[model samples]
Target: MARLELENLTKHYGGQATVRGVTLDIPDGEFLVLLGPSGCGKTTTLRMIAGFIEPSGGSVRLGGQDITHRPPWRRNTGMVFQSYALFPHMTVAQNVAFGLEMRKIGRAEREARALEALRMVRLDGLADRLPRQMSGGQQQRVALARALAIRPDVLLLDEPLSNLDAKLREEVRIEIRQLQQQLGLTAIMVTHDQEEALTVADRLVVMAEGEIRQIGSQQDLYERPADRFVAGFVGRSTVITGQVREPGLFESAGGLRLRCQGATAPGAASLVLRPEAIHLDPPPDEHNRLEGEVTFASYLGPVLELHLRLSAEDRITVHLPNRGGAGLIRAGDRVSIGWPQDTGIVFAGTA
Candidate 1:
């Protein structure tokens, strides 16, 4: 496995910086994901690592060696693109063996390695089939196999599953994660899908406007976001604009008093309340309680998403599980909403 590092990586185009002074160390065999919205320079960073885009400044290192000046083929980094990039006329086995042929491997050995890679992706029996003969998911696996057949020092995937159907995407994601873990390969994936990054990445680097916003595990990012941007970006959150009443308390314009953890003195800030963290019922003396009306409700199979009108201009969404109880409420019902004193996260600024 190869450890990848980018030090002070900066890329500029037409006098504008795309990647600005980004530095990160991806440990050997770790599944790291670069996650952000489109045009956030994630793909550009990956291209730099693959030697497709030369950095205007800084260096790229692989396995403790400087590879910033190396060519794509010389860097020994295998890339699986979003489009799969398979040769239309080549069979699965032939596609997998293409890289080896370029490296001048003997026919007999190349075929054996190709078969091994095909079997690793569970495509051994389909080796004779052309790309058009296979399903989207199968063809993607062949693409992965082709990349692996080259025995790269590091594997890079650029949203490899984005082309598959929803159900197939889920299945293939799990398959890809398992394959990476089993092979102990150093893999870096670039994706904009938050759920996909959370589901598959060992660690994630969140970016915006070509800059690294934050880097952490999924739980860390979800539970303790660093800023308002991150709090609103990673998951569903109701940004409660309020004035800090004290160290742990804030009072909103809607007359709701929110008690949060890790809050400071009286000031302007936003409280991030997750749907699952808010409760419909609160006992007397509970600190974080509010009054609202159920404006709308949708009966999802697992949970009902309730849109509560807290005030003239503010609406909060709450997710309630479908279970045996008073059942789902209607639009006109007045309700009291509460969250645990420490459940909601307080951000020091507005969205």
Candidate 2:
């Protein structure tokens, strides 16, 4: 395993910056995920680390050695591409051994390492099968084995599970996380899927446009988002734009008063309420209560997602557990919702 560092790493195309001054330190054996929406520089940053794209400025260090100018072949990094990038004609074992062969390892050692890597991913039995003969999940494991066969200092996964079906994606992500932890590999994955990042990463770096928004564990980001964008992106949140009227009060744009916590300096702010934090038919003594007309309801197995309109300009989403009687609330129904003051996170911004 190796510790990786990016120092003021930047990328530009035609004078337009795509990645801006991203400096991060990834400790040894840490599974760090770069998470953001499309075109947000997460993939570019991963490619830069893999030496597939030359940075416009800054440096990349691996295991305390400067490798900013090193070619991809010389960086000792293994990359699993989004497409699985397997050779159609080559058998699984051949594909996995390709990297070892490229490095001129002897034939016997390459074969041994290929089988070992395949075994690691539980695909050794199908080593002789062609890529086209296997399932998508199997092909993905072949790609993973190929990367691991190289015995790289760092493993880079670029949207590794985006091609699988929902069930397989979840299964493969669990496998990947288990393999990563078992091997203690210093891995960095670039993904737009928040759930995948939450499942696999030890720490997450949330990026936007060309810079980082926040970096934290799954619980930290979900429970205490740094801003409106993160609160909405990382999880489900009902964001209310308004101004702080006092230390414990917020007035929404629609003129609804709410009891909140976490912001003191009363300027323009946004109240971020997690959907799960709100409860239906709160008691009379509840600190924060609101009555809204249910606009829509979605039954999602264990939970019912409700969209409610508080007024012409204000709406909030609430998630109620799908316990025995949750189906009673439906569209057009007037519902009373309430949450504790501290349940709402108030950030000092409107945009």
Candidate 3:
């Protein structure tokens, strides 16, 4: 295991900057995830760290050693690609032994190490089977074994679970996290899946347009977002616009009134509301009160989604739990809903 460091790392293509000056210091044996949407420069940044692409500026250091210009093989980092890049002609054991063979280990020792790695991923018996004969999950295990055979200092995964089905993806991700923790490996993964990042990453870096938006644990980013972009991107948020009349008082042009529960300043305010926090058919409260007509309702398994069209040209989405028909409300029902004083946050700006 080793600590990874990136200082002012940057990359440019022609005159456009793909990755800007992003700096981060990751501790040893930590799992860091780079999460963002498509074309967010996350993959480019990972390639720069892997030494596959040279950076335009800054440095990459592993365990206090400068390896900014080192070759990919010399960097002692293992990469698990999204495609599961394995030689189809070779058996699982042979493919796993290829790394050790490149390092010039003897045949007997290389075979032993390959078997050990296969055993770690619970694929020892399938060592002789070809990738075509195995399932997608099995092929993924073979790729993992190949990456771990030479025991590289760091492990890098690039969307290693995108191809699998929903259930299998969850299972494989859990196995990967467990294996990483058991081996005490320093791992960095690049992914756009929010749930996957929240599940496996010790910490996550949310990036946008080649810049870092926020870096923290999943709870920190989900509960206390840094800005409007972070709040909307991290979770489902309903933003209502209004102007603050007093410290906690806000009024909209269509006669919608709101009183937030914090030390807020008087300005244009955005009331950010989470779906699960709002209750239905409640009396008018001092904090928040609104009446709306349900335009649509979707019956999800565990929860029911209610799409409400409120006054003031505002819309609100509510998620109600389905505990023995607790969500027995239908469309076109004019209902009054109120939330607690702390259910919504008042950002002193409109979006």
Candidate 4:
């Protein structure tokens, strides 16, 4: 395990920029996730760390050593690619031992190490099986085993679970997380799946348009995001556009008013509302109460997600837990949705 550092990392193709002055520090043995939409340059950054893509500027450091200019094979970093990259003709054991064979280890030592790696991923029984004979999840484990077999200083995973079914993805992510923690491995995983990034990361770096938007713990990102992009990208957020009506109040253009408890910054602002914090049928005189009609409702087994329209352009989704609320609300139903004024965050600057 080793500390990973990215200092002012930037990349370019001709004159077109992809990653720009991105800097981050990952502690030893921590699982960090780079999360964003497509074209966010997360994969490009990971490749730079692995010596696949040379950075146009800045540096990559592992522990105390500079590795920005090292070639891919000499970096001693294990990478589990999106494609799995397993050999069709080789058995799982042979594939796992390939790196060792390249380093000229004895046949017996390579085979023993390969089996040990397979066992760590709980795939020892499938060591002799061909890649095509295995299930998607099994092949993924084989890829993981191959990466771990080399015992690299850091592990890089590029959307390792994207190809699996939903259930399988959940299962494999849990397994991968446990394995990483058990080995005390320093790891970086890149994914566009919000749920997966939130589930597996010790800290998340949310990126967009070639730069980092925000970086924090999962709860921090969810509860106190830095800006409009972080608030909207990390999770489902309802943004209400308004101008400061007073010290702690705001009035939308559509006439909907919100009493933001801690709002001191004036002028054009946006109020971020989280679905789970919303209250239905609260007291009429409560702070931040809005009267609206339910426009859409969907039962999601565990919660009912309802979209309420305060006006044509001012709408919000409220997630009500399935605590007997399913029968109480429906589309076209008139309801008063309210929440604690402090529950909503007032973000200055509206776009």
TM-score winner among the candidates?
2
The digit string of per-residue lDDT tens for model 2 on 1-351 reads 799999999999998999999999999999999999999999999999999899999999999999999999898998999999999989999999999999999999999999999999999999999999999999999999999989889999999999999999999999989998999999999999999999999999999998999999999899988777888899888889999988989999999999887778889998999999999989999999889999999999899999999988899999998887658888999989999998999988778
Model 4 stretches astray by more than 4 angstroms: none
Write down the lDDT of every candidate, Cα atoms only. Answer: 0.89, 0.93, 0.87, 0.90
How well is each residue in 185-273 modelled by candidate 1, as lDDT tens digits? 99999999889998899999998888999999998889878777777889988887887888987777666666777888678888888
- Per-residue accuracy of model 4 over 237-340 as CA lDDT, tens digit each: 78889888788888876878777766786788888889999988788677877789999999988888999999877989998889874566789998888998
Cα error, candidate 3, residue 225 (Å): 0.7
2 versus 4: better lDDT goes to: 2
Please give the TM-score that candidate 1 achieves against the real structure: 0.96
* Model 1, global lDDT: 0.89
* Runs in model 1 lying further than 4 Å from the true structure: 324-327
TM-score of each: 0.96, 0.97, 0.94, 0.97
TM-score of 2: 0.97
Judging by TM-score, tell me the better candidate of 2 and 3.
Answer: 2
- The TM-score-based order of candidates, best leading, equals 2, 4, 1, 3
